[model samples]
Target: MENIWEVSPLHRQVKSEGEMTDLYKIEIRDLARAFCGALFLALPLHYTMEMWARARAIPSFMLVVILVAAYLLNVGYCYYSNFKGRPARQVPWLDALESLGVGIVASTITLLLIDQVNAHMSFDVIMSCIALESVPTSFGASLAKSQLSAGNKEDDLTDGWATDKKKILACLLGGLMFAFNVGATAEPIVIATSINYGQLIGIVVFSLLVSYLMVFMTAFEKEKEDEGAVMGPQWAETLICYSVSLLASAALLFMFGYLTPTTPHNLAIPWVVVLGYATTLGGSAGRLII
Candidate 1:
């Protein structure tokens, strides 16, 4: 016969209540971190007019794509780079989903607090804006383990020569973060510089060169001991990383309205290259720290 105390309705009820309480506490802590992280990285775009306009103009289908991309990025960061202690392969899907939700919720709350969202705005406008902003916010939330945790070391000794895909994804996330922080301010600077065709070409060359040096030749602490052991030829790895940063730059330029479908190919190419300069630095820095 089972023990009366173990099988008792009152005891089971008490155990269930205790479990629920602990779960609530964990959730509350996660919420606090998510809000703080999201706000830290997202504050600039929260107030920018370009972001608001893009939010309205972005189609619903693209918005869904953004959310899905953000989710995958966050999951990759959370699972591979940030939560190193936990076996990411075994991590439940729900936790990743919750972090994504946290990003959206935190962005919504911050926008509301800043008076960006109000009853005066159409529901579609508000939702679209929140979804657009959530990309960076969610990425930041995904990085909470690295950014928000106490005494979290930036370098991981166990991070051997990571697979090319992981390294590229890290570069993309870092570049995106850097771009989100500066893309809004870049338009004015780009316009003011009046960068001519020659200068634009030079900028592209310079960005690629700098990106290569930063990753391979810099005096910065080594990220991987077997850095020279990448699967492909050295130039191939460099090109892959450079391409990721360039792609990130283009995406950010589009999101910030610096590039549009109507823009001529020749004109748009330079701006993307120029922005890639800053974004590559960010990507390299991200690889170092993350």
Candidate 2:
């Protein structure tokens, strides 16, 4: 009788091809998710006047530093966040490079769409702008799997709505709840323009502390079980979610015309911080409940 443990050469070859095909599908899905995450998190910076202004002024060396820093951050995040539950072998450095490439491509395409990159701008300026924007986009790409994954039954509702769809709807509704009128009004701008540098910094620190407290530290809707499934440690998760809130705040404000190309960085940064406080609370709460 033929040995059950032994495989025929043709069978082995077919199995190898099947594995290769599965890996390709996983990689493609990962890339598509990365692109969506990059746009979701980094779109706000595309509208920030400060970002564009700083692009022209940023030193070439600093631009290089930003690129390297983004790659290193990607490596660390991708190590844990990419290819989850997949049979493929993990190569974090290679994944990091892929994330970085996605970031660069996403940034370039968005900048072009916004008319931010034109022939009149020097090549150095264009490159610097893209490099600066690429940092957040690459970070977003690296964190995509963790942040954008479909919700598990434990974390999602039992209703007929799909868990992933529910998760996304919850995020949008939560953000809109806090940011809608706030973005439409002049309060954020007034507060931003009125605050001194010290106060602005204090707002940022306070926002971070409050957001962390609301989502992670509090007993409100805390899920003790499956804590291991959550992405990153407490502090890191807090930081990432807070960053998302800030991005959301910026995008909302820009959409409302409160932050425009003519708006000064001095005001824009503070406006984002001020409005981000509310959005952060909503975002953290939204994710916590979901």
TM-score to true structure, per model? 0.78, 0.54
lDDT of 2 at 196: 93
Clashing pairs in 2: none
Q: How many clashes (backbone atoms < 3 Å, residues ≥3 apart in a chain or on different chains) does model 2 have?
A: 0
lDDT string, candidate 1, 1-290, tens digits: 33322234421322222453233444455567766776676777788887877788878887888788777767666654442222322142444566677778988988899888999999999999899888887767666656777524432323554566557766787887787767655573465259787887787678777776877788885554444345376567667777888888788777665678898876777777777878888887776666
Expressed as tens digits, the lDDT of each residue in 1-290 for candidate 2 is: 33212333322322233463344454466689889887776778788776677667667886776578568756755544552323233456777888889989999999999999989888998998888777767867765665687623332212455433333334443554446445645678888888899998888888789877876678985464333334456676667667777877887676544677788887788999999888877766666553
Work out candidate 1's RMSD over C-alphas.
6.4
Q: Please name the candidate that would achieve the greatest TM-score relative to the true structure.
A: 1
lDDT of 2 at 3: 23
The weakest ten consecutive residues by lDDT in model 2 span 3-12
lDDT, candidate 2, at 271: 92
